[model samples]
Target: MNHWNSGTAAALLSAILMGGSAAVFTTMPAYAQETVKLELWSRQDPSGPLRAGNVVKAAERLNKELEAEGSPKRVEVAVRESPAKGFDDDALQLLKVFGIDQGPDMFIAAHEWVCAFQEDGFLLKLDDYIAKYPQHFGTIFPSLWSSAKCPDGTYAIPQDAEARMFFYNKKLLREAGYDDAFVDALPERALSGDLTMDELIDIAKQVVDKTKAKYGILHRPNKGPDYIMAFNAYGNDFVDPASGNLLLERDKLAAAFGWFERAVKEGVIPANNTAMEFDALRKEFYTGNAAFWMYGIWDLGSVAFPTYGLPKDEKGFFADWGWIAGPAAAKGGSPVSLTHPIVYAISASTKEPELAVRLLGHASAADLNTDHAVTTTHIGIKPEQLEDPRYAEAWPLAKATELLKITKFLPNNAQFGELNGIIYAAIQGIESGRLSADDAAEFVIDEASASLEDVVVK
Candidate 1:
């Protein structure tokens, strides 16, 4: 519920003046030391709280530390205003701002776009500062560092990440004739590699036949990176190990599309899935009209239960819902959930880079980030963040933190956008029964070549 506004200074000064002795107020200069402004930009979240709330909290923390340390400089935060829109739309607007040489001091964005920003030289290389300030940068999970780096250098500090999984309605499955024990063992079956993709879909098929639910399984309505994990669960490697380029293995294409094909044919998935908005898909799962829903963990806590008017208590929210890391595509194959961070990247164009890093260091502290994590449905970025009492008390954050260890990541390539577009389009075609998996595979290959040109390695 914290917000950054233009009146923060006035409020701060009023609180200080009211609390202090009259003698101190008279002795202190009528105008205190100059305050350096830290401008930050993060996409406006749809619910719960602002994404930049912690950054403002961090600046407040840093100000206290600065005064205690006898430093003259004081830092205040300014959150740049932008249209309240989806992630990509806000990102494009930032890019347009950057075009006119007017980027913010720091910005928060999806790690997938880091590569594109680095290529454009829009990001500040943080190698020196990260080395000097080891406490802040040194402790990040090793896997996540890849997202902050390119062949040139490390450019950002990761904020937080979530485990993307498929959520199923336990009550609906029970009504659909699945015994309680079978329903309880679903995730274990998935983790131990006993559940295969076909069996997973078959379970949904049974639900459809026995229950009156409108759909058996549902996924994100639009094109993005989530389905890549499903394919990874099917034992498909999307990136070439040697070259680090995006790879499309034609052989596994059939199994990938086969899942959607079967879902549509069995009436488990609605034929008009792509036509639905995110809100409608969420309402479908919340209303118990769909047996399963797949999306990031953010929705489970931040958007679905509270904002959608479903339920808030853990029992009321999850009593009927269970989550799996999306069952493996085949028995003995690895089940996977995707994890990617939204990172804080400094603009290369900023005049006060050191001050920006200082602010970020304070902002990214465990206690400070806990403010954002507890309300936003995001898991802590560092292992130690799990120990924070606030993060520990939040049921959703506690349950999701452990799953971060088993999560997969998208390849760190700039062409990933082009690759995802082709694949998502092909998925739409295959799910609609308009393209066979083989045909979709070929179409992806052609589109990747044309769109990606020399970047894709087939």
Candidate 2:
């Protein structure tokens, strides 16, 4: 038989024997009579083909284990992969169009979407499901429980968590005469939550002066979601949940923006930040042209050391890099970093919501989820998962964990995207010398409040 025909026949056989959807049969054997099929959806990564492969393997392994144990219900998993085109805005629009029934059974989504989806009645309330199934819910972290919880107290289960930090070149530091002692002291200082915006700028200048690198910090000043990290670090809460009033914390923002403007004016930062794509900025860091890069831990596995089309032991790419938690607003202030928790939520219209919940639980088991966490270097929701040897095996986990403890989530309100855009434009203006720091701060507050006035925060 031809490959296509044989594959089709296998799918049909399994579906017939299990009496479930064709999607279920494709991922499992026919002998599992009570198999449940789950359709998962995620945005495809252009650079990382292994993401889909890993999810498949995770499901396949769970199926085999269930079969061996003679479990009554088997999991049949299928993924509907789509390109990650327009960030969360596009994803939200797509979810709205798909509604509850036609959407995937369970899919990965940003934490911010949970509140909006719950309010729209598009998501199933997992609290009862979690309460009944202790094994699955117990695996998640405590902070996630709160972050994923909606104002109405219904929400999705967190799948993975991520936090940002400063990526520095250790070798470059050494070249600049910063010995191991100085490098080792960074984390403690960062953890103390005292590093102010001005201190960060001074340190960047020191690194540039000492290393003679092209620039001290390679920062992308576009109005993307990434800038939320910087804004949060400065104590600016962009969205007020209670009133849905966009609050820019103008004083704090002005200080932070002034710091950036001064850095560019002093030549410590690249003047081309306004035009730099994330990829281009990363390339500059990877190639050793920049001393510091602020990015999430997710990039460590893929970009830090490109495995393909490069020497096996590519040294300079990330050799000089060491990580430090993002600097805080003031000495002794709470060190804040941004996190966008990725979660698994069931469609309210799913034919088998219970079955979807089970599959999601299986996927989140410490053993299975750890692999993805290690691969992506994401902070897992489960505390025990943090202790997994796999996490210890990866350096990014240690750094991410420390930062995750102090991290804060962006407001989950639907208008978050619009609020972010206003903030971004203001930051761009400040960086480009089009607006003074004080003016930029006022602009962000005035514009964001006007744009998001209709979004009821409660």
Candidate 3:
């Protein structure tokens, strides 16, 4: 069952903010006397439990700290929940409609949307804030800050960054005759790219033949930035940023898609994968119906402790689950992964821009943010935060961190969403046998290149 339904971003926002106004006012009887109350907007994975409550708590904490410091006016945070679907486009449209005068005070968004937000003048330039508040700003990962900066200047501050990898069910592997020795050695082999893709396929085949597991892997079919890691591992990219042209690297892209298609054809992956939503695929993996799943670090928390309606505790079910870098496509190639940070931006229309910036800064602090990561099982962007004991207890986070060194950012372009749509259509076409791999590649490139022509590069 796909837990994630197609919901409009605006509708989700309304749902999250339901009774939020009353809650905010209840928390702050003197809120009107406060310098400013900022309305922060963000979309969370509906299936994930952490986002909404955490943001509220963070705001409460920030307000208390300010009050303790004898500041007469505390910044009150009003959060609006946004749904994950078409969220980036919705945020862009909101920025355009509201401009700087009456939009949100702050927003949580993906890194890929940074360029679009900056180009549209929907975000506040954060260079001044960062400079004045160097102590608070210095805790973030340098790479994360760089990723959030536009060519013209800095705009957003990164909130969370993620790494994607392959996770396997160790019990399933062992039950199929692969033991600890084999499992422990998988990571190094996978990283070296010497782990031939064929070997993986063979193992999946073996598992199905020996065990009762329905499928060996559960990968989703949606085309978006998420698929870039697999494509990049094979030394292929969808678009060329420098020339704003679609890359015509047919052989590599075809090899990647061909491998995926072959997995489905071989009964290693479900034939109905194209119709599966991410949440359903995850549930299948968590319930032991599947042996492997490809997903971001966000999956770590729930998978490590299987809580959704499972009769067994997560540890009991996931005790044998292990993580490895995604398999390399060739010998001597570094294992490739995609790195994208979830960034926070101030709305151009915010009534409390300064307060919103302060709240964002406080939340991104190394210690405080590390706590959030530990609780949510997210990877930390700050180097110092990784050393914290809280992060140390999160095993999945530590494993994900190991994969970060080899990660690459997704294609950052104004036309990224449209490009992803083209890529997804082509992938579906090839997988379903509606088009040849070569034809699909050509179609993706032609459509993407045309779309890129209008993308503002700055």
Candidate 4:
């Protein structure tokens, strides 16, 4: 794979510029002279293309460019898939792999894990490389840089961003007697605070009561990131960004848990909500049986349209579904969107760190990233990609990106996961009718306090 032919530019340049024959280049040793295979680990994403897939594609491009430029080093990217059971599970597998010195040459991970991985010596510092290869990463969006940062150093390059929002079935809403104008104004009303969470639940209940849809509103079937938006909307500051300490108020936690508890009691959400699997929950909305679904933009391609086989430029999807940011819990309060980004990191154990970083930059370039964004339902991480014609074709990308203003991201902190799990358990208990909201809140605080000691304040 590393053999450069006589037809390469090196032969031409040697003949023209150096006044030598093609034989003059035969003795120049090729870059590491064998096909450099790099292992890349990606958490499986059935909803869309794994962000690591983008880097693999880019590495393929880099290989061709290298061969064209008469460089003997050809990159071969080997993908290692870890079960996408959950972020904690996937992160655990990665951490364990690194412990055994069997980690990949590169990896795609959530930015929230940045702090923990750096502290454990599992991540490579990229500041030096970023300075050495400015051209590859120079054009990255400044805002995305936050996803790659940690106190230790910048650990990775931003690969893709996903916005979690409220999705309603337009067809069901129409069947429930909403007019076309009303359907169009629903999301705007949500943004203006006219459509609060109470009203959202009421609307869903009405849809289910009046229409054939079996369900009304659906949230993540399992404990995942969607509920954090609800917590934030109810005025819970889960992290103290200044010191990266996990923090939450008992009153706010109770209010948020109570809202969801009411949702199940009102029959908009099922009591068995926590028992359903990811695929079944997604189908509840995509199959149009439920009035609303709270999920991320990543589903726009991998699951939503592909499951239905809808064509691009068709009005069916737009006519049948409308998306809104998560509604506020009360009147006069604003809705919130949650942004989670996947990042590409080179392994400290990699045989060739420079190649991995270069491949990441190639994958994040405007042309390559635009394709991934349009097809995978991810927002463009580069400024130039928004103007690309291919990216413009995916209508949701524009609207989703516009809604980035109200986004709340989980901070990069080690304790954030423990706090998140504590809250999710409370949600499950309260929503399942196993515990009252007050009891659930107490449980959350007690558990969180125990996990972090005095650091769990306010």
Candidate 5:
């Protein structure tokens, strides 16, 4: 899409040479003013519209700075919307867009895909920019910066993140004969690794047997990040640290798949879980027909509280609903949680990389980010965002932040999406009774080795 105003774009090149003091430019003519149109490619995700919208809003903030600095230029953001179904598909489409040299000035993407873009020379290296703009990025949590980095250096800005956990219905636990204290202690127990994966399934089993819940536990029906926490808990990181290659340990894969196998065999998870509609799965969990839903923090604002009339207040919500980290694979082992960050990256070919960086810097401002976080139930990238009253009011963000201490990210490897697809298929095979857990693990190993380059199998 042509995102620039007519004739204004032609003036952009000359304005760089025509730089003058504010007194000089302001006195000359309004016609002398230049507009730098920074086109942004963004997926039309209703859950996080502000992912792109905030960048557009930041143009106002950036233009004001430009004026104060006595520049003749003003920045305008043009958003090119993508109709992809999810981030994976959107990422693939973006790769082709960049391949043809039709990429936008900037784009929002899954953090995992930053390296993929970097590999193809499509991304601007942001290390220098990030260091120079201390005011913009100085207060962001140090931990999150890792998500925006590649093997060489930083390549993108972390936009937002959310915690993934097992959201359990406290009411169902109580109905299953658990006391309030017992139910409340579950999250702490999980954090300390006093709770194990088998214990979680057993608790779900109890809820199924003693309560009217039709399903004891449920997860997303499609390929996504939530279920990766289970694999992480079972010790499948999917990457070799020393070589940076995709790693698949057959036994570790089997252990994680075995959890799913046992859940289905014990009737905790439905046999056709992988085939169910997304809405139907959410309905079962939100409507109290399921005891536990494996999902993320955003579901509260995006689905549970708004769509299902869940308690909005902290105390009210905790009384009947709560969440726990993915329990440790064994007692005394580390628990796991996943935070899949969405990030912003500048195109390598953008005419105005500095302006694009500044624009995203303003977008990453604590207050502006808090607006996105509180409204969409996502965790903020900056520690300063915690000071915002609106952020404090969104208790789920604060509560979920506790899990970040132990959270893991999907590996930033370029081939991870393909590997995850294979792992997902193995899960489907196990759950559908087409393969045993051991067979599922073998399936993942064979499929990944064949489809992906440099896969390390053990």
Candidate 6:
């Protein structure tokens, strides 16, 4: 937080070389402390409540640092919570606020939407600040910073990341006559691409046929990142590397949609999946009425362990429950694990950009970020967090970290949020029996081409 410029050094040298009197020190005027209030915008999400709270805690930490540095400025963080149900909605609502010049000093947002904000001139580029504060950001995992970057520079600071996978009930698999070893090897099979997407459905079909479970496979009943992992596994990245434009390949799109089509046709995934309540889906999977629940890692701390009374310790948890990355589309193909990172960004219109940056730096401290990680079952941002005993105790985090080897991120395109909406709608269409896999692919193309700009179809 302290910067030593040339002027300070010049005054110090003059005082020392000229044998200046003590009056040089005594004549300096007192600093009346100035309180800088920084407002932060965040959604009212229960899963990662500390996303906003940590910034508040950072304000207190920054005040102490200011006191120690004998500086005249102290920071106060005021939180503005939005009532959006998900990050996509929150980002849209925030854009409207920014358009009106009412955006806060800083905001917590989904990483994929950071570029969208940057395009609108709503962000403060952070490359210089990140370079200035090595004590804070130097230890952050080098890979995670990519999520916060735009073409020009980094625009946000990654807060936390979690792995997405299909969580399965081992008890249900065993009830379907699979032995312990077969169930335990699922994660490894997924990573090695020995398991194919169709094979996962076949296993789920067995659970539905031989067991009393009503659902074989279940996913989030809304538009979100979990389902996108399936699309990614089927070789649809939805963006072009060469042109930096939205990319849509017809065959890949159908192949991904085909997986869902097969699931619904086989009665593995319910036809009304998109219509089901969120908590009901969790109850079905956690209470052993479903075989697989496609979701993220944080569900353990937020819902699975706490609400459903699942085993908390590693061995106990694995004894009845397990997870696997989205399996390959074909043998020898790569599996997929999608990581949706939440980030903290400062507004371009903020009055105190430097103080805001330093405050977020303290918020990203190893201990504070670990507090959020361990409490929510999220992976830590900094490498030093691996040594934290409390973090090591969070067994789910350590286990999920293995998936980072093949983890992928949603593209950081400005139009991706809107394009994701179209993709989700096509999913709903397929699950509800209104569209075949091929039809869903057409629907996505027509929607994206009509609405989004600069789309590249292959």
Candidate 1 RMSD to the real structure: 8.1
Model 1 per-residue lDDT tens digits across residues 1-458? 12335365445334433432211001122234866776787665644233577777777767777787777877877776454355565566566566556667898887767766777678899989988987776776666676677666788888877788888889889998888899889887877778877787778888888888888888887877777777777656666655556777776766687778878888888888988988898888888788888787778666776676756666775667778877777678777888878889899988788878987987778776777777777877777877888777777777767667667877666567768888889889977889887888888888887777454443
Query: Candidate 2 residues 1-458, lDDT tens each?
Result: 11235555555334322422222224676677786777776655543333334445556766776777777777767766554453484366445445423456766677777777776667788888998888878757666665677666757887778877777777676777777877657767777876665676677777788766777777665655555666677776655556433455668778777777787877777767867877788877766667777777777777665632322242433344566777777788766666777777787877788767766766677876677777666777777776777776665665476666777777776677777777677767766779888898778667765665653221
| C-alpha positional error of residue 359 in candidate 6 after TM-score superposition, expressed in Å | 1.9
Per-residue lDDT tens digits for candidate 4, residues 337-399, read: 888887888777788887777777787788877777777678877667778887777777866
Global Cα lDDT for candidate 6: 0.87
Candidate 5, lDDT over the whole model? 0.87
Query: Please, what is the TM-score per model?
Result: 0.80, 0.79, 0.75, 0.75, 0.86, 0.83
Q: Go through the candidates in order and give the C-alpha RMSD of each one to the true structure.
A: 8.1, 7.5, 6.7, 10.6, 6.8, 10.9
Candidate closer to the true structure by lDDT (higher is better), 2 or 4: 4
User: Clashes per prediction?
Assistant: 0, 6, 6, 0, 0, 0
Which candidate has the top score in TM-score?
5
lDDT of 2 at 317: 33
Model 6: per-residue Cα lDDT at residue 380: 88
What's the C-alpha lDDT at position 393 in model 3? 66
Mind sharing the TM-score for model 5? 0.86
| lDDT agreement with native, every candidate | 0.74, 0.67, 0.67, 0.75, 0.87, 0.87
Regions of model 1 farther than 4 Å from truth: 1-38, 43-50, 64-78, 96-101, 131-134, 138-143, 235-245, 276-280, 302-311, 315-319, 349-352, 411-415
Candidate 4 backbone clash number: 0
Off by over 4 Å in 2: 1-38, 44-78, 83-90, 98-101, 171-180, 243-246, 277-280, 287-289, 307-320, 386-389, 453-458
Instruction: Name model 4 segments beyond 4 Å from true.
Output: 1-90, 96-106, 121-143, 151-153, 175-177, 192-194, 208-214, 276-288, 306-314, 347-359, 414-419, 451-455
Worst 10 residues of 6 by lDDT: 20-29
